[model samples]
Target chain A: MEQNIIVSVDVVLFTLSEGQLKIVLLRRERDPYAGQLALPGGYIHADKDRDSLASAERVLLNKTGLVSPYLEQLYTFSGGVRDPRGWSLSVAYYALVHESLLVPDAELRFELWPVAAVPDLPFDHNRIVDHAAKRLRDKSTYTSLPCHLLPELFTLTELQQTYEHILGVALDKSVFRRKLPELDFLEAVPDAIRQGKHRPAQLYRLRPDRRLTIFDKTV
Target chain B: MEQNIIVSVDVVLFTLSEGQLKIVLLRRERDPYAGQLALPGGYIHADKDRDSLASAERVLLNKTGLVSPYLEQLYTFSGGVRDPRGWSLSVAYYALVHESLLVPDAELRFELWPVAAVPDLPFDHNRIVDHAAKRLRDKSTYTSLPCHLLPELFTLTELQQTYEHILGVALDKSVFRRKLPELDFLEAVPDAIRQGKHRPAQLYRLRPDRRLTIFDKTV
Candidate 1:
């Protein structure tokens, strides 16, 4: 009866593509629900891994040939007969990476699906994705979390669009621009400008030092 | 090698007493640093429990003889050889209760210690307590979490005191009063006034419907 809880780590990796927030999902290779869609995850290697975060990173590196710039512990789903093997617990995680960061790998195939159109996933992955998406949007309101969803160099217009995409709402252009300076992480690139249909907009990149910054308070 | 990961739930129950935030702790009875101080917790009974939250509620009830008004999933601490009994994971939870509600249990002695003065605890319980305290303070800034630390019936001044105690800072009375109306949860109890040293101050209580209200934005 003791030590009966099996532990695993699942990563809900999110990225933006074609102006839509998408989740990277992989097909499960083994049984319980073979060939079904599921988050990239694997059993926690107690002997080799340092912690759940490390286990999650290892799983992502092994399964998707990509490394996320930002990964946070989302939640731990346990109990209930979710796993056919036995009663199991999964330390779930959510990671954010620019879609362009994904490197093609011949051994693994990953597909990006719009979060709104996600199909019924294996186990409770659909629930995990939904929870993670909510967290991302919630944190985006105050923190620099949305910056991770965009490339290193981007125009202010592109940054605003990324936020709008994740939030699923069109924000007021002036209000968003006014709040930009308060974020204090965007450093204007002197000569960089993106020629949009209307005019050239100044480009900015997240200051290297602010890559891991969480704003002290909501603006 | 399967089903080797041990899973448990730990509860960090906090309450206000003597105008200070205190945590409820229990002394261990067996081999795990026997007789040492630790957070109230127990192994998840897979056969009887529904999930980690249910397990936490059960443990709190059986050990402390009281139910928490607010219980949240704080964080999950896993991996590391913290547990001498092999690889184990504990889903840590933090709860809030009013001191008046605790009915002393002779068999199960529970003591409330100031959060800042907590002594070294057994296992990773010390780290769990610290993390939960930080989360409480962080959430207090945006949510109506300060309400949990106060009794069901309290004055506006008492409510402000509770917030000040948790935040460890002084607030402007007029500014606080101006923001009170926007909370939308405080209802004045007519004819119920506390005759203080100077004058009678009106009494108030959390509106029954908004007891669980979490403000949409920070004050």
Candidate 2:
């Protein structure tokens, strides 16, 4: 009876690097398709906590030696035939890490690939990444999830550029600025940050307490 | 190594009934929490298809005796000890079905519960449902996914009510009407649908050629 159940967790670590959305993938060291690039993941422990999110967190930390960042469930892959050996169930999670915060250790061996240029991943991971990418693009238009990937304080132009990169389209600057007041969840700082060669733009931070509900907003 | 792989699939089926959002659930028939209410799911087959989505589609049809409808990958649940028996992974999918399409067969036994008053579900399915509900609410704001739950030709009032029921809020009539045209995905039909108490309202349908894209007009 114990042999019938197999649980695993896969993590899709996302970050913005060099103006592109990148995902962290590992080259498997063990057999059963060793050296294939795939998401960092492993089997669940019977003695661990029952909560799926906590289990995903534990597996991620063990594999990459990284603590929690911005993690959320992506989707579950339960195919009668996903595993060659037997029936294995996998719960996939997507995480966003600020590019500045990523510190890869020597012991951890993985490569970060741009989402647009990633080759085929092993065991249906490509599909998982595709779904998460689409969700990220869709959610950014209506929710505050995208802010989690950015620095605490950012210029409106920087934020808009992030949106453009993910959505793969140029937006109207005038209309975009006109819609900012309706967000209500962004608060401008009294001081502005300056960059080279252009005028300093106002910096804004996410107002968690404001809790903007865009349930009816035009997406 | 043989003991490490375990996989499963869970499905969240959504339908509109009597102008309310409802979910399909099943009463457990076996041990490890017999008689408990849970999502209809089971172990993945090892030799069927390697794709997670295909696996989900196969399991969904087997358990519910239903064919394809509007389905999307929702989220994955992988906790180390979610299953008391052993390690198990679960991939979840969300499906939207029109009430008229559901064929209640004797082979499939389950109950439809209103989203507002769902009872305790087995494992982490309760949390899964909550996440799916939130996604449905948020997706309705920008995409045409919610239209899958409505008839081919529906009134604007019906569309608004569908949004209201899923969002759990009363939207302003004028504001919602104004936003519909901005979407550019809905086309008004020449015919009208009559409600019992109100004047005949114009009906509308989603444009087949206009695919949903996550792009800002200004960027």
Candidate 3:
């Protein structure tokens, strides 16, 4: 028996801006949900390469005019009734891009909102964003993923702020400092860096040899 | 605007048995392609809850004739051409259950195979399995998830075995043991227990305060 087939890709782009976490969203200019804020996405081609990662890159570049960055497959959305159109399946991906790196050209119309102020998204995209947010929060607790969203050689305070923003909790300064040394994944740089009106804080970069492992360590 | 609507859910049931990591899979009884080993799943009903987690539980319980154990949303599969019948999306969930607890009845014919022995699964299941396996491996490195598949108060050897099985690696016993003390998640019971012909091994249990966090501690 023949079956109708539909496939699409959506992106949840994350960035750190003005000491807060933000997400990239767009307003659709065409039909089928025009003017609604939605995660940028599109239909998949029949002859497209089977690599979902590559497909995500293609769609994101086409829609937002952004190129290669740290992208990972987030999840899939396939519910019979999720779409008003025919059978549609979406392969959703989450990307970490520096805010300064985002260059919105003429092709795309979008805005970046601090995660806390994000409005209602289109087509279950809110759920997708929530999932990515949870992953980001949980991952930061154990992995070096937060580093991707930060500037190179950031201060301990800056790093901690990113965690606090994602986790939504005030962390103990001393306790957080004690935990950093255990994370052999980070390497201290030669010079301390100053952020306006504050004492220069120690700068550190992600250790190259340190691969992210989801192993628990005593705090 | 009339799009064919199709939806499905696939389960990745994981268990630890005889010091090996195994997955539960079903042999297709009837289909456009029958007599093949595949994940147990089916279409979602419109009348059902919109929560994917709830829908996954309902579909998994129906297919396996088993109650819910520990289930986590893995990923969503939506590649337009993944389903030949039409555009279909499959929400996949990965679950961990004690092998002894699963009593698959006659209706749902399935076999438990080591992750290594699993054949090329149908559809994008191979990809799904790959993703779930990676998550399991990564999570096992630092979380209390492995303990969920083991009996209460298991020996360090058994715990190590579970790690080896999931990670597909022979970790140094001494190093592995040393690392345990660093992980506040495991607590040793006051009483030591002997199993088989070996000397009494320290029995350990999961610490209630130390829950599994889905983050990679880059050490």
TM-score (chain B only), all candidates: 0.92, 0.89, 0.88
Q: Which lDDT tens digits does candidate 1 get at residues B36-73?
A: 88899989987788777778889999999877777788
Docking class of 2: acceptable
Q: How do all the candidates rank in terms of TM-score, highest first?
A: 1, 2, 3
Candidate 1 CAPRI-style tier: medium
Worst 10 residues of 3 chain A by lDDT: A210-219
lDDT of 2 by residue, B1-219 (tens): 454535667889899988789988888889777998898777665556455666667877877777745667766655455676655566677888788877667977777899998998778788878878987887888888778888888888888888888888999999999998888889888766655677767789888766332121111
DockQ of each: 0.51, 0.37, 0.18
lDDT of 3 at A37: 87
The window of 10 residues in a row where model 2 chain A has the poorest summed lDDT is A210-219
Regions of candidate 3 where Cα sits further than 4 Å from its true position: A1-9, A16-20, A28-38, A41-63, A76-91, A98-101, A104-107, A119-127, A137-219, B80-83, B188-196, B200-202, B208-219
- Relative to the true structure, how large is the alpha-carbon lDDT of every model? 0.83, 0.74, 0.74
Count of clashing pairs, candidate 1? 0
Error of 2 at A59 (Å): 4.7
Best by lDDT: 1
For candidate 1 chain B, which ten residues in a row score worst on lDDT? B210-219
